[model samples]
Target: MTAITNKGSGPIIQEIAAVIVENKAYLSEIDGKIGDGDHGVNMAKGFGRASDRISAEDTLTDAMQTLSDVLMAEIGGSMGPLYGMMFSDMADHLEDTDQIDAAVFGAMLRAGLEGVQEIGSASVGDKTLLDTFVPALEAYDSALAGGADFAAALDAMKAAAATGRDSTIDMVAKIGRSARLGERSRGVLDAGATSCCMILTGFADGIKTRLT
Candidate 1:
């Protein structure tokens, strides 16, 4: 029953932001193949802005709220609104929780996923972020149901996120700007899926290190 405290976990978001900022160029490069080529730039901008506002003593909920605000208001592209709503829903789910155990985290993840699904038209296998996000959540839940601890469930989620991201390589773009490319989009990985993998693995790693 490993859990991480809700208090003073804002730095985890900062670390996640750093990961996004550091990979900005690479993400954009991936997007250049099939999309507008601004995914990384927009992601880095929003996450970095949120990181600067988040303090070390702030709660995870507070940090995520800030991230959601920035992403929704400052970043451009469809992802901004999708990710913004996701984080907002996730933070709202954890607003009153003091400890983040497997069950609690799973609820938060589901909230975020639902937020994304509610506002977006894409579904699983659409070669979108849902490709990575849905599988990761399912894996996390399955691991916990199988009697794995919180940390192990997070590991399962991270692995599934990576596999989902990779699965996009062979998928034809079914939505977004890439959809227009049809068959031409099959060989390249979906940029949204890649970034979604980063975010999920970031959460898993951050929580794993804080588990007690």
Candidate 2:
């Protein structure tokens, strides 16, 4: 029966931004192995800016919209548009919700994934963020379906996200600049998947903290 109010949950997005900002170097390091090394720098810049725009008066939807706007318009790279659409879709799904329960949260996650798939060509095993994202959402949905509570479902999601991120390490890149590396890319983590894990876990932790 526990849920988190949309109101005052803007800080959850802020927390996500903070985590991205703090991990900028690590993300870039991973990216540098197979692609451009600017993943962290760009992600940190956009997320930090979004954090500044987030206000206490903003609801969860409002905060997500602000972040979506920044990522779509300001950041450069394929990630910008992909993540922009993801957040935009999530915010749209949650726009009228006063409380986020497991079902609502699942809808939001599915919406985000749909939005990303609409604009992205990557799929599971492509050595992209979808590797982490697809499994995380599925795990969350399965947990809810199996009679787990909201917090427990979130735990499932976070754990699945991490596992998915780790899975990317052995995968050969099938898209993006990394694809050119072929077998060379197999030993390193996909930067996008790593970042996706961070974002999903941040969301899980933030929502768990706000459960009422």
TM-score of 1: 0.98
Tens-digit lDDT track for model 2 on 137-156? 99999999999999999999
lDDT per residue (tens digit) for residues 80-113 in model 1: 8999999999999999689888899999999999
lDDT of each: 0.93, 0.94
Candidate 1: list runs displaced more than 4 Å.
Answer: none
Cα displacement (Å) at residue 85, model 2: 0.5
TM-scores vs. true structure, each candidate: 0.98, 0.98
Indicate the TM-score of model 2.
0.98
Worst 10 residues of 2 by lDDT: 1-10
Positional deviation of residue 21's Cα in model 1 after best superposition, in angstroms: 0.3
lDDT of 1 at 43: 95
